[model samples]
Target: MSDAYVALEGGSVVAARCRAPGTSHGELVFTTAYTGYEESLTDPSYEEQVLTFSYPLIGNYGVRSERFESGRVHPRAVVARELTDDVAEWLTEEGVPAVDRLDTRDLVGEIREGGAMKCGVSAGPDASPEDAKAALAECPGMSDYTDIGAQVSVSAQKTYPGDGDADTEVALVDCGAKESIVKSLVERGATVHVLPYDVSPGEVSDLAPDVLFISNGPGDPANFEAAESLVSEFVGEVPLAGICLGQQIIARALGGSTAKMDFGHRGVNQPVRDLRSEKVVMTTQNHGYTVADPGDLEVTQVNVNDDTPEGLESDDLRVLTRQYHPEANPGPNDTLGFFDDVLDMVDCRTPVAAD
Candidate 1:
């Protein structure tokens, strides 16, 4: 007999095995990535969401703390066809709900047809369909979580010294940054100062950083007014860079508009093409919003599948942004050069002709 019940927005209740006991609610979304379960689970971008693994078996390689992106699991709950004991135990210890032994293929199909929607999960020996439905009824939509940044970002400023000589300084506004992003910059000889999401412009000006970076985060871009304000404040003054939601925030601050995607890209092998060179590369992505209008920035690259803006750059303003993750924790290393491009902007203070 099933010990877990999942209530979807459409009124359908799916019975599943209880891997970890708890009750939770969030927006239900799926990821097609076949590996990197550990990194994906810890990603701050998964905040306020129920993550469903499209792959059948998860935790084949067991779990390790070194593979974690953040200090804790970000997803409110997890759904899968089968979850190994290691992952299940980890989720239980983290106080996050986990349910498996369900027809994930069918559930994924439903999400594709209906888009990401509100979901509720009730798991444990005493779990009931009514319990899950009750959670679902009370669950707020993603946009309604106006204070989501506070849930994932750091409360105080922290700094990580660069690995080597530490030539450049980067002031990173941590909306919800991944540890890998810090490591990536440190490895590149950059001293990274991670600041709070709601930090003021005066606080940033105190640092006098060579580059102002906005880290990837969760929730609607419009909600991160502080990060957007930072973007506007330092647009022409400091070289700017961002990734994932960082890209969306930069666009919004510069008069660009962002809209919700039907089902945002959440996988390892998303193909992106450069408009200038027409070169293609696979990237890792996890976002529910897309840039609709680029405002003053020039579109440098786009997703091959839907032609959405994937890379936004402005040589004049020394601003660079990407809609995909270039840190390549669980994805391809194809876009690692993105960091190089962003760091290069430090030397290009004066505007140059678009190449």
Candidate 2:
């Protein structure tokens, strides 16, 4: 007899043991990463979602705060085949629900076929399948969390100095930004000012940053109107860059459109090919939305598997964006050069001559 139950949107309930006791609801999703459990847990992009580990055994390596993408776990609940004492204890301390010792393969298969869907988890000595179902009944879809940015972004602007003698200035709009993204910019001789998602265009104009970078976040892209406004306000005036949700926002601001993916890309091994260079690289990704139309921006890179626009660029507008995380905290370093390409835009930030 198990003390935990996971209720899916289709009225199916799965029994499991309680690794961390609690009750929660979210969009059920999975990641195929075999490592970086700590980073995945703390990732802000996982906000409002129930994270399932497709890997057979999780927490083989102990949890470490240094590896975290954010200060706390963002997933509403966690599902796994097995959980180590270390991870279970960590999730418990964070007050996040967790359940394991179940058939993760079957759950992953369902998500793959049926797409990400509403889910609820009830885990504790007193938990019941009915409790899980009740949570699911009340759970809202991801698009409904319109103000999800407030749940993960920093309230006030925080600045991080670059390595000694930094030469560039970057104003990063934090729509649930990962710490690694900031660290990556700071390490590259760029003073990074992380602003809240709702920062006004005037405020950013006052800063007059060398570049404006939108960050990865959760929820629907249409909901982030402020970030999209920033992109429209600074398109040709300042170098613009974005990742994951950031990319979607950029495309939306540039007369493009975005749409929700079936299951989304949430792993460390997605392959992307640069259309211009004809070079392919394995990348890390975590977003439920993709740019269905690039608008004014040219599609410079695409996913090898699905041909989704992985990279969008506009030389005339001084803009560059990627649908995957180039900082790659818990994934590959193949795309880390993305930061360099961003800085190059700063060097080329001359005003376009009027026709």
Candidate 3:
């Protein structure tokens, strides 16, 4: 075992064992997901964040390419109580920093208490904890840092043919979206034109899509001015939807507001109750900020644990949004009906995304 250290923004450091050697910076955060390490590692939502796993034992199942959420790893670093050999090798091969024998229980507790903070990790097997803490001064804090959505979003327009009969035409604003989000739509035969984060109203209107989708992405939703601009142009004129950061954008566009969570939800099993269904279903979620108040909008769902807004809708604007991931790649599909509801709004005669 080599040396590794997690440095907090407050200038404290935790000593640990280094599985991969490197120095990296990100917002110090944790995920409660016990499985799906591969999906979590590649999820665009984890971008620029040093992830701490609450599951004490990790990587026992080994790495599998089929489970990847994206083409590559997204988290800046990995921390855990025990890192398996397979995960360590994969992290080392990918040039990502990772550490084990790190007191993750204490780390998660601290983060939960203080909220996510800008931090750095150095995994040199003989790294100095103090040195890592000192370097934290140079790293950008998550709140002040911008450019997160742009970093993960698509830069060009690409169209994918629907796997179904191609009845519904959908325009998706790729604000750092996950692959499953598109797959969920395309599987139902919806022609999807994936656009960039800064896509103009003209570009979207040119598609003449029956539905407009704003996707989940990293960083603060406030940083995504262009997405908000697009929302302003299309709201009330088109059937629109958003997820995660997309949900936050809709809130802002509709006169509501977003606020950073004390510690954002990043996990596979979150319970949210649908106001319409009166049923609580498990969901997947990842976001540092949440809609504090969904102004003038009907609250659709609420997180059972925290009472935070999980879903919002505006029948007037024909828009619906969920702050959790309903496309669930590595999570349960209980809330997949949200997508079916969106497709229904698209006038899809058939119930889609039911799987």
Candidate 3 per-residue C-alpha lDDT over 145-223 given as tens digits, one digit per residue, 9 for 90 to 100: 5677778888899898999566787889988888889888888878889999999887777778888899998888888
For all predictions, the C-alpha RMSD in Å is 3.2, 2.3, 3.8
Q: Of 2 and 3, which scores higher on TM-score?
A: 2
Question: What does candidate 1's lDDT look like per residue over 135-170, in tens digits?
Answer: 999899899999899999999999999888757888
Residue lDDT tens for model 2, 1-355? 9999999998899999999999999999999999889988999999999999999899998988899899999999999999999999999999999999889999999999999999999999999999999999999999899899999999999999999796788999999999999999998989999999999887787777898999998999999998998788778888899999999999999999999999999999999999988999999999889999999999999999999999999999988999999998787999999998998888888532232
Candidate 3 TM-score to native: 0.95
TM-score of each: 0.98, 0.98, 0.95
Q: Please list the residue runs of candidate 2 whose C-alpha ends up more than 4 Å from where it truly belongs after superposition.
A: 350-355
Q: Whole-model lDDT for model 1 versus the true structure?
A: 0.93
Model 3: CA > 4 A from native: 348-355
Tell me how far candidate 1 lies from the true structure as C-alpha RMSD in angstroms: 3.2
**lDDT (C-alpha, whole model) for all candidates:** 0.93, 0.93, 0.85
